[model samples]
Target: MTAPTLFHVAILRTLLIVAALVALESNRLEAAAPEPTQKIASAAAAFLDTLDDTQRGKVSFAFNDAAQRIRWSNLPVSMAEHRGLRMGDLKANQRDAVMNLLATTLSKMGYEKVVGIVESDEVLRKQSPKGAPPFGRDEYFISFLGKPSATEPWMIQFGGHHLALNITIAGEQGVLTPSLIAVQPAKFTLDGKTIRPMGRETDKALELVQALTDEQRKQAILGSQMRDLVLGPGHDGETIQPEGLKTSTLNEAQRKLLLELIAEWSGIIHDTAATAKLNEIKANLADTWFAWSGPLEAGKAYFRIQGPTVIIEYAPQRLGGDVTMHIHSMFRDPTNDYGKKFAGK
Candidate 1:
């Protein structure tokens, strides 16, 4: 080969420098944006490492086991409705490891909400009537649907009386639908502070309902009472007819209120997943429907928001003949429950 001229040599050096700069920039971006799925899997493995063999037996299950995947309920463990490793069985260190795993899977706000819900259950235990099932912070169970892997699908199912957080991870995406959160003795004093676990969900929903016009109210109010969530627990992959008022008919202010109401549920997951869900709902806003039942007043009521891929329901339980003090609510994605997209179902 002929030796390059000075001009050719200079051009070659410039191209080489440009290539190096591009490679460095790519590496920086890659390092900065680690896959969240890997973080979740690492956290999950760390948690499992802290468990003894016997505890592992209780916490681990086949990912494809359909029964185990659906083996969660709002009822207390004393009711014999759920199975997994109970939080009470874990040592303090082990419990902290579990919380770390949850932190990896949820946003800060979402993590706080989960902790609040569990703590509220402790309050419920104190106020339960005679013969009621055992209720407390430690009554919650945590289980892994499959072996944790950065590239594979798995689930983290944690729940107890009045709370169930079913978080599914499929590659880079995470789904927090098919989760239930409720509270009994809804308002309680703890450490000299009042705590209501589902307060935002209740209040935001009521605010939206109250903002409706007379005609909007007529279209949105249900003729019959909704005593409980239509898609709670075992009712996964179910669909409900869009009832009540459609979002397309609502004024811009009313529609904004509706979005805020939906966020109270969607915001319970990590921000990335929550943002994806909220955008999905917003894209389908025109098709979304809102329905209400019972007294529209502040203390007690039932409401539902249903759309193409989302479903949210709030129902107050009549336990102890006090409708206002007990509540049940759920968030579900009909098309993506259990991370069906990642499962290739």
Candidate 2:
């Protein structure tokens, strides 16, 4: 080609610079955009691909099937009580795929808590009451509601004895509520380390409750005992009158303690979603109430925090009058369980 004139060369340089600037702006826009849920959708698809036809049939459920969505329980699969594909039935590869799916939805801490709860069941199996059905890590089940999609609503239901995680995703938002995490032999020795899956939950609440003055404790303590969560599985969309000491009455230090307790549950979801949920709860702190039952000792008491958007309960199972070793806890959003906000329910 012939050499360009000075004017033409200047114009060409200007166009090239403009194009380079445009490309950089485009890259910046792409990076700043919110991440799509396609990663989770792809992970779910991969997990399903690992399943055989029969397993897939068992694992998948209709999204609108209210009965199936609420069919989860805190009973071991050995009891033949839950409906879904059992981890015990899966091969190593299939199990890994299922875990990969969980990693996509739960934060690193959330995923670790789940695995810890499942492993704790093995301890329960060894310490079981005579002839009390089998309990172990393999007893957990994984189920899906609707087809996984980045732009559509779907849910992942995974639970077993002492654990339930119900995660609903719609567009860019995810809700993890109406979830249960508990432990039998609430504290146990594993690999020479004492593990307490629900320890932060139990200890943190106890700290807050104990910090209250005798007068404050009187206001915070409930007259009636809470044997189980009022809004546990199958108790969807229910509301309870706010009770006990209101956050408005708490001093700044005490309010901080309460927020930390709430984080034990809300922080279980991925960081972005958890931050959003925590912000919502914090905004309504003045209207929130903390109620307590039983003794103030860790692992032995029952307590709940209720607010406009959140309800969390920690109850120790009282089978045969034995309460200290077994526990049950739930976290729920009264306004948005199962992504009701996005579903327009």
Candidate 3:
């Protein structure tokens, strides 16, 4: 190989300097990025920056507005008016910003679940009966109960027909409670891939129930039928007396199955937040109860997992033609809904 001329050497030197500058800039950006604990708040702030004053006012509410905190539902906006900036009204960039906040707040699977639920509504939109309320992905709304801060309490309320996520953030903790995760067409196809918003929730619960011994099943089954959610939507801060078999009775294998089932809900938030939440749930597993009210052979069923800190219910809507086609599930932290404990309500 020939030695490079002075001109070639100078050009190579210039290129190396440019590459170094680029790497330095990339490193600076990476360092400036918020940590996992702060991402949700940072994303919320970034979203706010994208909005004008009027839009910001529409999306923000006082932290102490108790009414606003519980003003969420699984009903369409036409039936229950939402107090936030409508997804449909947002500009492209603004809408993207809101989605970014959601992605930042929830785990990958959780974010996909939310999107799937919304897309299922879009499916419902096209199949709506005459004069029925509107249904679509764009019908969802996003609101913030307080200014987003990493160390102080705040909330993010995002929901629409058949879905509601009430995520509260305080310090390094992020709580997803009193959230409704539901879908009208429980199964659908998006981008050519089959999507079931609550698929894992259904499958995992089924696996747990199926793993039960004969005696265990008898203890787990409920006498009465459950057609809908008892603690969904408006039923916040309330819990039914736990029924069914206590998790403490489960063998180690069955216990593991139960924890996996619970994770379908607790693991919906960002991993860092989910890990803390899961640890608490595991600690209380001994006191947790698992109850089922449906067929043991096959098909959809209604099940409830109630413990000291968590109450999760999965009820497939029976009145909606095909019971398996519509589903509603609730996730609540009885002691910390809306971060009440963290905020010292």
Clashes of each: 0, 0, 0
Badly placed stretches (over 4 Å) of model 3 are 1-34, 297-299
Please list the C-alpha lDDT of all candidates, in the order they appear.
0.84, 0.84, 0.87
TM-score of every prediction relative to native? 0.87, 0.86, 0.88
Give the least accurate 10-residue stretch of model 2, judged by summed lDDT: 29-38
How far out, in Å, is residue 307 in model 1?
Answer: 0.4
Alpha carbon lDDT of residue 329, candidate 1?
A: 89
Q: What tens-digit string does per-residue lDDT give for candidate 1 at 49-147?
A: 998899999899888888888888888787757777888889998999999999888888788778778887887788778888888988889999888
Error of 3 at 68 (Å): 0.5
* Residue-level error in angstroms, candidate 2, position 239: 2.2
Model 2 per-residue lDDT tens digits across residues 19-102: 999999866654543463667878899999998899999999988878888888776666647888988989999999999988
Give the higher-TM-score candidate: 1 or 3. 3
| Ranking of all predicted structures according to lDDT, beginning with the best and ending with the worst | 3, 2, 1
lDDT of 3 by residue, 238-277 (tens): 7699899998999999998988888888988999889899
CA lDDT, candidate 2, residue 309: 91
Superposed by TM-score, candidate 3 places the C-alpha of residue 309 at a distance from the truth, in angstroms, of: 0.6
Most TM-score-accurate candidate? 3
